[model samples]
Target chain A: MKVKKFLIGLADVFRFIKRFFKEVFYPPFEIKETLRQCFLLGNRSLFLILFTSFLAGIVFTKQSRPSLASFGAESWLPSLVSQAVVRSLGPLITGLICAGKLGSNIGAELASMQVSEQIDAMEVSGTRPYAYLVVSRVLATTLMLPLLVVFADIVALLGSYLMVNGINGTSFTLYFNEVSAVVTYLDIFSSLIKSAFFGFAIGIVGSYAGYHSEKGTTGVGKAANTAVVVSMIFIFVIDLASLQIINLFRVQ
Target chain B: MRTETDIIMPAPSQPRGNAVVEVRHVSKSFGDREVLVDFNLDLFERENLVILGKSGTGKSVAIKIMVGLLKPDSGTVNVLGYDVPTLSTKELNALRLQVGFSFQGSALYDSMTVRENLEFPLKRNLGIYNRSELDEKVMSALKDVGLESASNLSPAELSGGMKKRIGIARTLILNPKIMLYDEPTAGLDPVTSSEINELILSVRDKYNTSSIIITHDISCARETSDRIVGLFDGRNKVEGTFDELKKQNNEELKPFFNY
Candidate 1:
């Protein structure tokens, strides 16, 4: 039963992605509404993303201090923190946070619309709901996540600098030079690519869950909850796959 | 015990002007539960047809088929002379411009205000862009539904009747030729339902649009339906003008007249 449900879910996700692609590039693009969704989903998530990434960097530095110090490599803390924040931790944590916020939000919103016949109303009115609802959201998340990750990496690195300063009285300028020296453009690019994929996962999963919601209001709630859980799982899957691709590039 | 299959076929399509919506021999089933079977309807130009059925009797399914929202298992649903299920996505979308549907839930967008909801179809479907014309149209539609004052409110802020009015107003914004209303009075109080019925009549008269209102709200049918068709056991059963049908002596049809 579980395997059957999983296969069905996988197929549904593929179909949703297919539909998004088909309708996304069509004309009469609902540009204004898409911008509104981008503002709502992306800009609205800034505070939560900021708070999570800040805490993540502080915790990472605090946890790693003793081990690195035991190895007598304490001064390397700034570079190490920057590498972790930019390459993985910042984006991963940001993705997970957005999966919770935007996933539940988009899922609940669309699921409620499904229950209320707003979707059908759109369909029969000759306004393509898929183009307006799914494409705009997926595009917003795909474009915005990388931007959010960039913002998060900056905030997290700042938190990491504060942690380093608290531990060994390291000056802000000195910390910055260390981080800049170690963190290459490759690290920045890979983080940006990975976060974009994470955003795609969040948008697609949330939309699929909500769009296919059944059993009315209870189903809407379930769809929202499932969207968060499933989106988080997809984030991890994407992280692993992208890391492998990055590894292939490194090996070459 | 008598199903349409055993004895009745859909009543012979009486001559009505230029059949704009036709559902012929259409049957639909979900799993083993058949919702519609051999259902037939001919909605003529500028006619108000009410389809009456108890809950789960496929009145909703019948309309869904008419609007191309659902495909029948077998048989054809043609709207405005175009076959519904056979139309390509692009073609179906184009066809949708002439057909307006009001959901039983009054499915207003929760994120948009009343004015925005009304403007959605106008902007997209009708391709109307002149700001003054758009404003004038929106106001007229809202005023027609007695909701001109509530134009700025979110759908969540509106009462049940108000939401239904907003739904009808939004449908009107496109100036569609055919309106498919699914249980327009399903969840309202008696007074509100009556008001909705009156609004349906007014909309029909004002717009001269063909309509199929699916409801068990007998009073609504009596008030607005130019012709009332009963759907029973997954097929079209009996149809007549409301008063003529009410005067029928059939024992099995007795339950429907209790209203």
Candidate 2:
């Protein structure tokens, strides 16, 4: 019974995704609402992303220092840290943070609206709630995630520079020059691409959970929890898939 | 004790105006529970038709079907010359523009101010975008509901009665030909409920809208309905004017009136 329910739910999510694609391209696009959502998703999440990415960069550099010192490779710390931050950590950290933040937000918000009959009210008012609510949110996340990833990448690199300068007095120009030399345009592009996928996953999962939420207060709570968990799972899956795809093109 | 002569038969009177909405032999069920079975109703032009039933009797469902929010399992719903169930998305949306539905909970958008809420349907449905035009229509609707001063307040800040009024105002901004009010006075003190009942009557008079009001509140029906349909056992068991039904005191309608 549980297996059957799970399969049914999975199919429903697919259908929701298909409907989103169909409605998103249709005319009478919600451009103002989409931009408003972009501001909400991006600007509201900026502080948390900055604080967490900064800490992650500092902590990761500190952890790697002793390991590289043991092998007399401490001089290579800038190259290693830059590569990791650009190629993986920046996107992964930002993805997880947004999955927890924006996913729950969209889920609980929409679930509450659903329970309160606001969605029905919108339909009765001759407005397409799916096009207005779901499409704008999904587009916001898709558009904003790449931009957020860029911020996370730059901030993380800055944190690494601060740590390196504190330890070895490495000048800012020298540190950034080495960092830029090691991190190629391909790595930056792939990281951004992965972030966009993660954002799309979070947006759709959260929306699906909220849109199909059962009636009442408990349903709102469940929707929020389900959105966060499902979005995190999707982020990891997309990360693995992107890694495999990127590996195929890497010069061995 | 009411005598047999006092009991009017459950036959509905012929509405004086043309029937604007017609539901025939509609049946709908969810899982194992049947909500409406062979249900039928009609709302005539410029008339206030009340569907009076208990909480679980599918009063809301019947109205939802008329607006194409819910499709009937085996029946036809024709509203404003469009077959509700078979209409395409574009057609259904066009139909919806003519039909304004006021939900039981008011269902105001929490994020928007009262002014924005009233402006939404106008901007989206009618494509009215000029700032002064939006403002004029919004204020007019607010004035109709007697809440023009409360336009800037958030829905959260308004009292329950005020929220309900604003919900009606939002729907009224579009100047719909038909109105479907789902329990216009479900949760309120008697005084507030009376006020909403008055608003319903005034809206009909001012906008000249044909309405179907779903409620279990006997007083609301008595005050607002030009005609009442008593729903029981998933079907309309009786229909008549409130005074006629009150005089009839039929067995099916006794429970509704006795309260």
DockQ of each two-chain model: 0.87, 0.89
Quick one: best TM-score, which candidate?
2
Q: Which CAPRI quality tier does the interface of model 1 achieve?
A: high
Candidate 1: Cα lDDT at A155: 91
- Stretches of candidate 2 above 4 Å error? B1-15
Could you tell me the interface RMSD of model 2?
Answer: 0.6
Write model 1 residue lDDT over A10-122, tens digit each, in one string: 88778888888878878878688778888988888999999888888899999998999999998888888998898889889889999999999989888998998889889
Q: Pairs clashing in candidate 1? A: none
How many steric overlaps are in each model, in order?
Answer: 0, 0
User: What is the TM-score of each predicted model, taking all chains together?
Assistant: 0.94, 0.96
Calculate the i-RMS of every candidate, to one decimal place.
0.9, 0.6
lDDT of 2 by residue, A81-200 (tens): 999998899999999999999999999999999999999999988899999999999999999999999999889888988999999999999998999889888898999999999999
- CAPRI rating of model 2: high
Off by over 4 Å in 1: A1-9, B1-15
